[model samples]
Target: MDTTSVWRATAPKAALPSLQGDIATDVVIVGGGITGVTLALNLAEQGIPAVLLEARDAGFGSTGNSTGNLYETVSRGIHRIIDRWDKDVAHAVTVARREAVDQIERRVQKYGIGCGFRRCALYRYATSEEGKERVEKEYQGSLDAGLRVRWEPSLPPPFHPPHGQVMVLDNQAQFHPQAYVRELARQAAGHGCLIFEDSMVLEVDTDQRVVRTVRGKVSAKHIVLATHSPKGLHLVQAGMVVNREYGLATRIEKDGFPAGIFWGSGVDRISARELGVDDETYLICVGEEHKTGQEDANINLDRLEAAAAAHFHVRDIAFRWSAQNYAAADSLPYIGKDATGCFIATGFETDGLTWGTVAASIITDEIIGRDNLFAPLVKPSRFSPVKGAKGLVEENVAVLKSFIKDYVTDRPGIPLSQLMPGKGDIVKVAGESLAAYMDPNGNLLLVSPVCTHMKCKVHWNSVEKSWDCPCHGSRFAPDGTVIEGPATEPLQRHFLQDVE
Candidate 1:
């Protein structure tokens, strides 16, 4: 039950040091994923002094845990964009995304990056008649979006016969996203951009343009909040829907599956692909999306494993992981300056690998005073309430209920003695409810259940062994340190007892 992703397990790490003292640069990127690393390289190529900081390692967030599929169309369907906006807008989105995928290929080739980048056709097929209309509309939408799409009679091996329509979009690509980010960081570092790992930003003073880490600080004229959900409170969080999707990999024979991104929709939605890491071939299947902190992660992962086994070969599971995604209210990512004047890029949904590169390109263009055609589409200032109303309303209402549930309802807590090893719960200790966990060695660690982001009650994620905030997707380790999301501060820690 190892939670590390296949990509992260195989890719080489990007070795970098943590920030020691205060440093100044023209631009400071606050994430080391594809967006921040690419932005750092973009700035360095332009002879601009910049610094990149990562909370953990490069691509440790959604980048490393992603499906590694890159295409013009999104998982939610291109028909969504067309229906929300217009044909022209959909075309623009596809054009911009295509360019981003091409940019990745260019970087891999130009720098001789060993990321296993390859061009392949994307197959979006329906598993049953219920999803026929979806694939049909997606095909039409792709054509409207100016993509070279065609109706295919069948899909490649390992995929069952399409029950409905099969849309094939050629020239789409896939790669080892973790390796790409690691190599991108190296390229940026070689070009004079300072890259720091294990330098989590504890504070960001947008007014003074300063980022503070545990040991040092960074001062820059411009700041880009590329961290998945930006590192603090913002207007965008209220409009975004946070969800976690599961991904798993299992061993497969050589050339067992076709080298392509195949998405099936019917009884369920799943993305399947094949990866050859060194001498072993692995089949990756990803699906089972659910709201973070709302659903049981263990159950969701179990469903994913069952579905993969049901549809594919009966190989034993090797790697399992999950990633969080924020879908914007307006159906587009917020990728520019907010009211706070600091640049923010979020709400990339599940297409972060491509949208992240687009964000870096747009942000870099703005910093260099260059006009980018796609900048206007994803600007943070744009308001599309009508188009984004469905998700915005649904998600905000859930947030409101979380507040009510935390305060109004009573949660039955268990005694510390009953809390088993490798288990956690809201335990009743000393007449107070505390977030408690018993380590494998029988150590009881306690923390406040209140979320530091907006005071929502934290729920235990049994699968990941962390406290997750239902309102804003903030997650904390068993020791209460922030893992991701908008919370910069760790959960308040409390000492209760040690089981001996």
Candidate 2:
């Protein structure tokens, strides 16, 4: 069972029926994940009649598989932001992130959604004395950005080489993101917003401001491409964003965990939190950030699980998942009108919860013809001579790599004859070794077969009876269980052998 897909586990049954004929609306939003749904909700609140098209069910992307912690700022490396984006831009991004958290909180209170919402602090600690300098530099950056942050020296365990320090910011929080988004979707539906699931958008007419899905076409005055990484824009060579992240939830038996959101300062940081599911205790572990299509996401999970075992007493493994975010090379989310009628809110990296909210507000503001505070920082068409050049080279290189590796090279496909009844194999399928297949009665079944989030080879975890993305920690069942995410899509089935 894939434990990585949060929407499958948390959200109510989605309203998905094949879209019939041509429909017209004032605005059409593609991608029903948090960004898309939240954008729709924002627009509805402003009395706009918009229709949302989701490739799958709502909250089926990072929102479903999130650790649900709304870390309002860059927890990884602030220096990276300064390197790619201007100081003012970085500062505005931070403020926008905080505003995202505030928006979520406000919506929760307004709708009375029961999603385990809480106000907590986020801690970023350094592993070594050298790392302490980096942490302090970030602290100073926070201050220089007019945000006061507290520095704590001599932290407890999990801080290897303990001579280093830590930084903590208050008022950060987390929750069951699926439940929260479901409520948002319900409210949006009540407020005159239409959401259609299982509607994969195949094309977009930026010139005409029209969106075409597998079933029907939608003609609208404006369009919002909030599909995490801009799925449809790739055909146009306008560029799309991609980044990979991992998360895990473990059953903890230990006491005195210090109950707050915790993270590290290294490139592959680790975050831990106490999560409640029924009567059991689960510690949500997250980190292992990297560019999408850059590396095997499972590697991050191994590193984080090792850290979790070292730091906390585990009773059992409850769930593990991964998420991918679109990181613009400029280190800012693309949240504005691109052409005349098309708007986008992507490249948010891993801060989508906050940035998604920012995107929603800005996109709504754009539709309403109001001045948006985030306009200056999140311009979609903004060009950065240095970052844009580097990002273009890097992203295009990845696109070329994926195209060559995933598409053109067709070798001997996985032999379904090798699969036996009631057995599964991580054999070479889909031209990649990470794909898996199983047979209940001698039939070749193709599920997501591969982890779409980071192209990590998913392992058939027999113990869990699920396809586990060992790299970034996403899990799905032999029957294609989307228990976790970053991967909103399921293990697509390619039946190779017939059951006899």
Candidate 3:
């Protein structure tokens, strides 16, 4: 199976250039994922000039690796929002999510973006008694949130038909995420927005309203931190729990394959959707989530492959990829101006496809001096101390435990001869910890094991072949380039001859 995402493999390459020198705009957006690109498009459409800076190419990050399902319900469940806040907030959340989906549809049509966007039904099924109860509670909560859901006694074949009850939510959508986002960047550029790729923002001066990169600086009237986790605000990082989830696409037989999204409840909740490329069809299955750097990536991949094999007629695994998500302690995304006055959007969990659009809408409204209806509910600075207290403590405790354990633990100290090609591990070299990897050509590469974000030790992700930070989900390539992050810097490179 290919390690690349199907979307990335199939989507067209983005051709945007990097930032050259100092530039100024009405707004500066510091990411090029769905949120940043969408926010750029929204602002540009409103006749606002903005500059978008991407560390890498557009959609190269989580947006490219995402499973591409759009849903109105939050990843943790709608009931969690009801329990934390009130029914009104939960209902408002649902409404806002639906609006985000509709906005995507409208933009695709209006811009003539051929991203294979399609509306499909979503089925949430239960496989166990606990799952059944959870589904029932979610069903009621969904209805209370003004969603139209129908109860199904059984799902069709190729799914757990008679084993569990199903709740079907209609009019949800999916698309080629990378394709859509790239088109969004193009459309934003067409509207006179400056789009830059490979332009990393090294620092943000909130007081001066300026962002600086190695090559240039952007002074803006407003700024939006659309990075996966907001680097501009430290508190936003602390309030989120990072998760790593795996996905695989398998070629499927045409006859029994389902046409809509299917989700199963329980601890090992699984989601499946079908995609068509040319005349061939493939089933994309994603699940087996764990805290970032907590579980073995190979194990998660195996579980997903096993599940896909058991449920459907799989010809072969076409693609395998993984994405990271950050869930807020309060079950809602922080999507407005933070205490520092810079607009931010993060903690989207698995529903970023929709919430990213919602963030764009809300941020654009704020930039254009209009009031957004959902801004107050999702404002970044707003906190529910009592309602989110337990989750905040639990998530932070996990972070602390991981930080201390990685900091104190000794490395395995495996020699370069013992390391296998296409794999990496942490080792002790010259009385210092180093991340070591052997390239396919038998060349040894070493870098500092400490994550640049918070100095936490980074563990090697075998499946993805990268060093992943446990504390905050920072990832780096074996060559020490920053892949994804709350961290902005690459791992420090170490010379092989320096080894003991």
Candidate 3 lDDT, 269-387, residue by residue in tens: 78888877666677898888888887788988898787777666554888999999998888889898888888888889998888999999999888878988889988878778887
Q: How many backbone clashes does candidate 2 have?
A: 36
Model 1 TM-score is: 0.98
What's the residue-level lDDT of 308 in candidate 3?
A: 73
RMSD of 1: 1.6
Please state every model's RMSD to the true fold in angstroms.
1.6, 5.4, 1.8
Q: For candidate 2, lDDT tens digit of each residue in 28-116?
A: 99877778888889889888889888766778777787767786677555656776766776677678778889888988999998887
Ranking by TM-score: 1, 3, 2
Name the runs in model 1 displaced over 4 angstroms: 497-500
Please report, in order, the local distance difference test score of every candidate based on alpha carbons.
0.90, 0.67, 0.85
Better of 1 and 3 by lDDT: 1
Distance from true location, Cα of 449 in model 2, Å:
12
* Better TM-score candidate (1, 3): 1
Cα-lDDT of candidate 1: 0.90
Score residue 170 of candidate 1 by CA lDDT: 88
